[model samples]
Target: MTTAPLVRRAHDRGIAVLTLDSPHNRNALSAALIADLTDALDAAERDEAVRAVLLTHTGSTFCAGADLKADGIGKGPGLLVGLIRRIATLAKPVVAKADGHARAGGLGLLAACDIAVASDAATFAFTESRLGLAPSVISLPVLDRVDPRAAGRYFLTGERFDTAEAVRIGLVTAWDEALDGILAGLRAASPQGLAESKAVATRSLREALDSGAEELVRQSARLFTSAEAAEGMRAFVERRDPSWAL
Candidate 1:
């Protein structure tokens, strides 16, 4: 099978490195890219030679999020969700090496991992609200990683948050000057133990969401059509701040 151009996977030091490769577009998660990632993750999970997985990207961005051009929308496919679900449940650790802006769906990918290490320059945002779209698929993962009130603020505002704010909000586990050193430390730990711990933590959150799925959808539907949401989208397209107060 031909490898997808959007992702490249390699194994070394018992760690499987999955590099998001679409630098031209800041590694936007097009449907083809999502399909490739699903396959790559499945392969990594089945390979006993791989002890842990490290997700990173090639360009200045870790990921810019879903390809808005392809889908005319930002939601991920079932396979993408399944891949994230497996990352949470995997018997091996999954670490995110966030090197740049992890926006929208990209933030979802980081939250799905077992742990995340970001450079001092890394930035995060939940920008879908500004584009007349809801972060329906990524909402649960973001909520799990950050405080409820913080999630509400950022998700509603679609504002960019820096590394310090990301750390403060609990979106990332660590911020470091050298990403290599942090990955080295994670490599020294027991992959099995990390995997088990992540599974336990994420499973609980998933279960709670499952029980409240209906209410969640209803709320999002309401927000999607709200006048505020319309203004947000218009402001974004017009390249001006939203006049929401008016």
Candidate 2:
């Protein structure tokens, strides 16, 4: 039997809810999923009825970061960067309903959203440093959203943090038990007003990401193909510590 699609989208009460449905890989940033998400966002942008968007996921893990085991990692930086930038600059207001953990590049997705409502139980981390790589492309959005000192600490240490810390560091807008109120508030906005307001609010971020994306993508590609990152990926598959950890 054929597998289900990686992302599922539904529309209700002027809100377009796009869910990451690939629990098998914990919603990893595989090429297929990125493409599907882009399509969903594009459709939502074109739909006049979709005044807002809620970005959520199905599994306990919101996203486990890049699917390094998959063949797409070599070319994933561009796709992932594009998707994140799309979310950041999308005309409609996008809210992340983060009910689970987000790590590494996954944190970039959360940061890209205009508003993020995470559950108290949810967690976050920037785990790229642990893998002998840097969060280069993701830094565009992450840095814009997070506190500079906090970003530096987490980026360098690859430390895991809880929802409270995530909120404190500006990784999420707020922590809510349920997303109903947030969605309701967003859905109540006038479509044109919301769109124009969002455009104004995100101007600086959009310009920064657009100008820096090419360089960040090149850096990501270089690191992903580096000898240290290769060893890190190999060790991850072998269930052993990377050489740098020794």
Which one is best on TM-score? 2
List the candidates' TM-scores in order: 0.81, 0.95
Those runs of model 1 whose alpha carbons end farther than 4 Å from true positions after fitting are 1-4, 74-80, 177-186, 212-246
Q: Which ten residues in a row have the lowest lDDT in candidate 1?
A: 71-80
Whole-model lDDT values for every prediction? 0.76, 0.87
C-alpha lDDT of candidate 2 relative to the true structure = 0.87
- lDDT tens per residue, model 1, 137-166: 677677788888999999898899888888
lDDT accuracy of residue 38 in candidate 1: 70
